[model samples]
Target: MVTTRQGVRLLGPGDVDAFLDLARRDPVANVFAMYRARTTRLEPRWLGGEAWGRFHDGELVAACHVGANLVPIESREEDARAFGERALARGRSVSTIVGPTEAVREFWRTVSDSWGRPRDLRWNQPHLVIDGPPTAAPDPGVRRTMRAELDELYPACVAMYTEEVGVSPEVGGRNDLYRTRVAQLVSRGWSFARFDAGRLVFKAEVACATDDAAQIQGVWVPPDRRGEGLAVAGMAAVVELVRAEIAPRVSLYVNEWNEPARRAYARVGFQETTTFSTIMF
Candidate 1:
């Protein structure tokens, strides 16, 4: 258990192993992986409280962060206290707080009254856990097809993501931060989608995965063709590929308020395992 103060140095691959240990208790490994990957890629100035943890006796017991998320640690409540202090000292105002729902709630409870509350958004995202037996493989079936030729897909994916998040996905070269994960997925046998109409309108991506799980992200249908519910079939195609190529567990994030998106996901066999929140002000 490393002491809380020593963890002031928590960033980069230093905390990778410990973080993975904590994620083991989590249903989806990708949730943690995506953020970790972002940390490595952006090297975002360690912007103070960039990462925080509370460990006891040389083991990480609790952790949190400020980045793609404000992940408050709950496995150890004391760490959350330490993390909040560190974040405030840095004069930080993060874009969002994304983490285990309850952990996030507790974090907010501490500062909401003082720093003022950000917009509260709940997630109804569902995760597909691997069942007792392996599922059947896709024939033409399941596959994660990375596009070497479709340079056009990036903008389209950005559009889809913006629509999904209700904010524009970064259009400037700024979002290149995600390219590493994109490339990582491609290298690790991840799948992205292309429509038969010859447009790169639909795709599936994973933020993180391992032998036991392969969490997914970036599922989208183009705005021009959304009414057709193309996202469902497209996601199904991706799910089959995930089932075949990646780990058995395939998961995705859906905004809690987005009923149509939730319905589409449930129709494809996803079930809500828990709630999560992404606080953005």
Candidate 2:
């Protein structure tokens, strides 16, 4: 790890333990970073980008994951600024900047001028977590998606992505990559959904997981199925299964303005633990 002028250095295999220690400070909030580090072992060849560490007084205090997504782990304002500067030097390569609200905000402040306008800036996202059984009744009908169901599930995944992100996953010729990701999740038994007469009614996926926690993403109830309480019960089932087989804790973040989704998560027993921010390109 050669130190840079700003005390930020590219992390490698040698820094895995220290990086894990730093990220585990808040496992739910740091699950994405921890998952990446564990799977890639801090190797750039595997990471497809890099993990960066900020050292102070010869100790690793904070770190950032830079790849398709830029995520800061337990970074303070100054530390995030330094990471932002390092990213600026490397040019804008990530599709999104996301993390704890303050750190992401500070990181953006440092790079925004050079990075120019973002497609969207979500300044307030509630980071929620649940460590025990959900209060709502689990929907027994909801189960892990089978690999054979890929052709059936793919369209719903695309719909959810387009509705949530305001763009089709097929845009920019990424259909195959997105489809493969969905298939990978199914193969890992991380994708969950409920179907009625072979038609999908609700869906969600475990975006990442570590021993400590798992993060949920791409939650959706078809527009016609919304308000039918599918999400609440489906999430309850998801939480139950994830804790039983994947991790002890489950987490997810939602846009602050999305009140209905927030209410559904609350009904499923999720509690707000922190705030996150996302700047999407």
Candidate 3:
């Protein structure tokens, strides 16, 4: 462990236990890091990124995973500053920085000049979490997307991606890569869907799964299915299933401007836990 006079330490695969202990201090807020730490074992070479830690008097206070997704786990201004300086020193290698709103914004303030302006800044993201059974009745038909349903499910995944991110996953000729991810979700039983008369009606994926929580993503109700009470029931079903089978709690973050989503989640009993921000580079 190389510790700097400033207390910033670059963590490697060997530091998994310490990284995890730091992440567990607030499980829900640190779900992403906890998930990656457990699943990836802090491996030096993991999905094209690395993890770094900030220590204070030999105690790990914060950590950042920099890669395709630059995520910070409950970092303070000082911790964010150190991580930001490290990122700036590396040039613009990260694709995004996402975490608690304050930490992300503070970190961005430090690296914006070196990183250039972001293509998109989702600043008002409400992080919501739900525990126990849902209040609304779950959609009985909701179930995991089967391997055979990949062909039918792929388009819905694409639609959700394009709608949520303002650009198709197919952009930059990455359609094949996008399809593979959807397939992987289905194959791992991480995807859920409801079909009416053999047509896909609603879909969601457990994007991050930790022992304490499962964060849902790519939730979608087709354009024609809007205002039909599908989202509430469908989401209820997802929450019930995920809570019972995957994790003890379910969580997700939605853009604050998405009123309909906020309403739908509230109907399913999800309460705001925190605010997360994302800087898409």
Best by lDDT: 2
| Regions of candidate 1 where Cα sits further than 4 Å from its true position | 1-16, 27-49, 73-78, 113-120, 123-148, 171-191, 227-229
Q: Compared with the true structure, what per-residue lDDT tens digits does model 2 show for residues 1-281?
A: 57888899989999999999999899889999999999999999999899999999889999999999999999999999999889888999999999999999999989989998999999999999999999999999999999888988999999999998888999989999999999999999999999999999999999999999999999999898899999999999999999999999999999999999999999999999999999999
Q: Rank the candidates by TM-score, best first.
A: 2, 3, 1
TM-scores for candidates 1 onward, in order: 0.75, 0.99, 0.97
Pairs that collide, model 1: 1-56, 1-57, 1-58, 1-59, 2-58, 138-141, 138-142, 143-241, 144-191
Deviation of model 1 at 168, angstroms = 2.1
lDDT of 2 at 49: 93
Candidate maximizing TM-score: 2
**Model 3 / residue 141 / CA error / Å:** 0.9
Output the TM-score of candidate 2.
Answer: 0.99
lDDT against the true structure, each candidate: 0.60, 0.95, 0.89
